[model samples]
Every structure is written in C-alpha cells, then in structure tokens.
Target: MKCLQEQAADGTHLLFLAAVYKLLYLLYTKDAATVDHVLRHRSRRDFERIEQSMQYVKRNYTNPITLKETADELSLTPEYFCRLFKKYTGQTFLTYVNQIRLQYFHSDLLQTDESITYLMNKNGITNYKVFLRSFKEAYGMPPGQLRKKQREVRDAGAISARSASSSGND
Candidate 1:
C-alpha cells in the first residue's frame, strides 16, 4: 500500500490501480453486484455483533459488568463470547474493561485533585492490590507516583510562566 504512494505513475499504473480497486470491492462486497447472501452475511453479522459488544462495554465500564452478562446481552455463551472478544479485541474481556477504567482514572488524575483510592473506586476498580499492580505495569509507576510527577511538572510550568511575566514587567 505504501509503495503505491511512493512515486508518480503513468497510464499502465492507472490501469493497474483500477484493477486493484475492483478486486478490493469484490472482496469487500462479496459480489460485483449486490450481496452474496451466504458468505457476506455471516461475516457482516459477526462484525456487527462484535461491535455491539464493544459499545456495551464502553457504556458500562464505570459499572462492574460480568462476562456472563455481556455474553447474555449478545445472546452468546460465555465461553464463545470470551473467544470472540479475544479474537477481535486482542484481549480477554476483563482486560478490556480494566483498560477502559484505567483510561478514566488517568484522566481524573490530570483533571482532579482526588484521592487515588477514591478515583480507583469511582472507576469501578474494587481491588487495591490489583489496581496497583496493573497501574504500575501499564504506566511504569504507581498511581500516586504518576500523580505526584504530573503535579510537579504542572507546578514547574506555572512557576516558569510567572517568572517570565514578572521579568517582562521589569
């Protein structure tokens, strides 16, 4: 794909590009005409179902949701849902939920002066030990350390701005 954009092309290249596009379209739509009903439907349905599961997770991340509940929501068995979630998202179900909660927690760290425990609990992380290990693994430090570093950086920037402004006044 990058090679296609590397250089200018002439008439033969234009023809080749057209053929490639037609081939891609056929592959995506299954038929040169409408739909193939057999292969396309199965793939499209599975993709849509997986997308629906992801949206469900995003909506309910701040609440503790179970694998059984999510699987039930999509009318799939828990075992099958686990496999599908792993296949599409490249992580197990709980891992994905934790990632979402961690994102919310990280945002709150920057935006609020809340306690670490409070933020973690608010993000639906009920286990302190698990949260500590996961946070350290993902961010390369514990939440408290990350928070302190961010504060130091913010304070330094403020002090620099004030010094610059005072110097300009002199």
Candidate 2:
C-alpha cells in the first residue's frame, strides 16, 4: 500500500498493480515438483533461442521484420522457427509483431497528442488498410477512437485513485 501510495502521486500506480498480479501468480502456482517437471521437459537451448527472438522483436518491431530474418538471426531455419514459435508462444510471427506494435500504439496514444496516422507511420506500420484492420482487431476500435477511449479510461482511473487517497487522509 505504501508503494502504491508513493507511485500514486505520479499517477503511475497502475503499473505497480500489474506487477502485484504477476507476483501473486508466482506465489500461488502448484508445487515445486510440477514446476520442475515442466522445466525438465522443455529444452533450455530452445527456450534461450526463443527468448533471443522475442528480444529481437521487441527491439526491431518498428522496422520491417520477417520470420526468415528472425530465424536466420537465431540460426534456425524458417520452418523450424515457425513451428517452435507457434508451439511455445501460440502466435504467428507477424501476429506477435502486430500485437507489439499495437501495445506501443496504445501507450503512445495515451501519452502523446500525435495523430493516429502519425503514430502508425512513426511505428513503421505503412499500410493504412492493414493497420486499421489489425489495430481494430486487437483493440476492438480504430486507432483514433481507441486513443480517445483510452485517454478517458486513464483519466477516470487517476480521478478514482486521487479520490480514494484523499478520502483515506480524512
């Protein structure tokens, strides 16, 4: 609560709330042997390669990215990389990249006053048709409208947090 109170001053406490949920998941999962069994069944090298590929995507999602390039960078064939990536992460490479792009768009939309076209172009999403389709598919709204909706949500959350804190003081 103290940490929340401190971060609340800057309206950044929601990020900490997400961390709290993640920590709760780690604490509430089943026994160590179940964890050990799962860990023992998966190849560490394969996981490492996938982790490397995810890091690559996070760093380069704003650029033109392809499965072949990521596979080659990870020293795996495109087919193998696709199979492994789908099995482990359950998203096609392009879908994953688009999801990352959407997340970036969402954050920037909430923080900046840039137009949707500008934000999409700045994020390397060149095709307006494709951008609109994917952005709507992921967020259930078009980018321009999504920005407005997200801003309203964030503003409401900040107001609620402030009210709760002020009332507690009294």
Candidate 3:
C-alpha cells in the first residue's frame, strides 16, 4: 500500500507494474489450490459414479445390457460413461459385460455337465465365435477342454481314494 501510494505520488509506472505482478502471483497461487481441491472432489465423485455403473452391470449382465441404458441410469452420456468405465476398469463396456457372463459360465461349467452351447446361451452369450474367443482368452483353453481336464483330475482323485479305501479294508 505504501509503495503504491508513493508510486502514485511520483507517477512512476514501475511500481504499478510491480503491484500488478504481485497481485497476479497471489491470484495464481490461490487459483491453483482451488483448482486442485476441486479436482480431488470431482475425482472422488467420478469414482463413485464408476462404482455405481459396475453394480448396474453386475445386476443386469445376465440379460442384454446396453451402454446407453447404463449411462442413462447414471445421467451420463454413453460416450463419457464408456470412457470413464474403460479408464477405471481397463476394459470396454461390452468386454466387461461379457466378462461377467463368462464368469457365470465358468462357474456353471465346473458345477454341472451342461453342454457348452447351452451354458453359453444361459449365461447370455449369443455369439458363438465371441464366446469361444473370450473363453479361451480368459481361461487359456476352450470350455470343453477345461471341463475335460477337470473331470480327469476328479477321476484320478476318485481312483486314488478308492484304492486307499480298499487297502484299509484289507
């Protein structure tokens, strides 16, 4: 204040420039902090939205789930929702949905003797090619092969158990 008043008295532009520079520096520092705080808040909110979208996917993945419908439920545009989903999950929406379906398919495959085609359809997988590709990608083998391997292990275990039981009986 004193310097500016003195500058005004002398009509010197130097002091005016200095004051302007100081004001700008202070404003910039304050604005940067404000921007950071806002970004943190926005980031937390965005993550919450992403979580909500995931829950929505889990609930509806057994049926036909569209990106647009999920986005609409969250009041976000499909494009933005897709971007956010991929950014957080490292997978696109359709891929995520198919992943969930594949998980269900894997569980059913292990627990039941259902045909692969029937299991795929039951898990909402409509495209045979896509299902085969995704399943192989996920499990490193086709569904039928995995099932066969599991059965082989089971049979081996059963045979060992039976032999052990016979020896014990003797």
Instruction: Look at candidate 1 and give me any clashing residue pairs.
Output: none
What are the per-residue Cα lDDT tens digits for candidate 1 across 64-160?
8899999999999999889888987789989988888988999998899999888987888888888788889999998888989999999999999
TM-score for candidate 1 = 0.75
lDDT comparing candidate 3 with the true structure: 0.91
Error of 2 at 152 (Å): 4.8
lDDT over C-alpha atoms for residue 63 of model 2:
92
**Which parts of model 3 are misplaced by more than 4 Å?**
1-11
The 0-to-1 C-alpha lDDT of every candidate, in the order given, reads 0.86, 0.85, 0.91
| Off by more than 4 A, model 1 | 1-37
- Which pairs clash in model 2? none
Q: Which regions of candidate 2 are displaced past 4 Å?
A: 1-42, 151-170
User: What's the TM for model 3?
Assistant: 0.87
TM-score of each: 0.75, 0.63, 0.87
Q: Give the winner by TM-score.
A: 3
133: Cα error in model 2, Å? 1.8
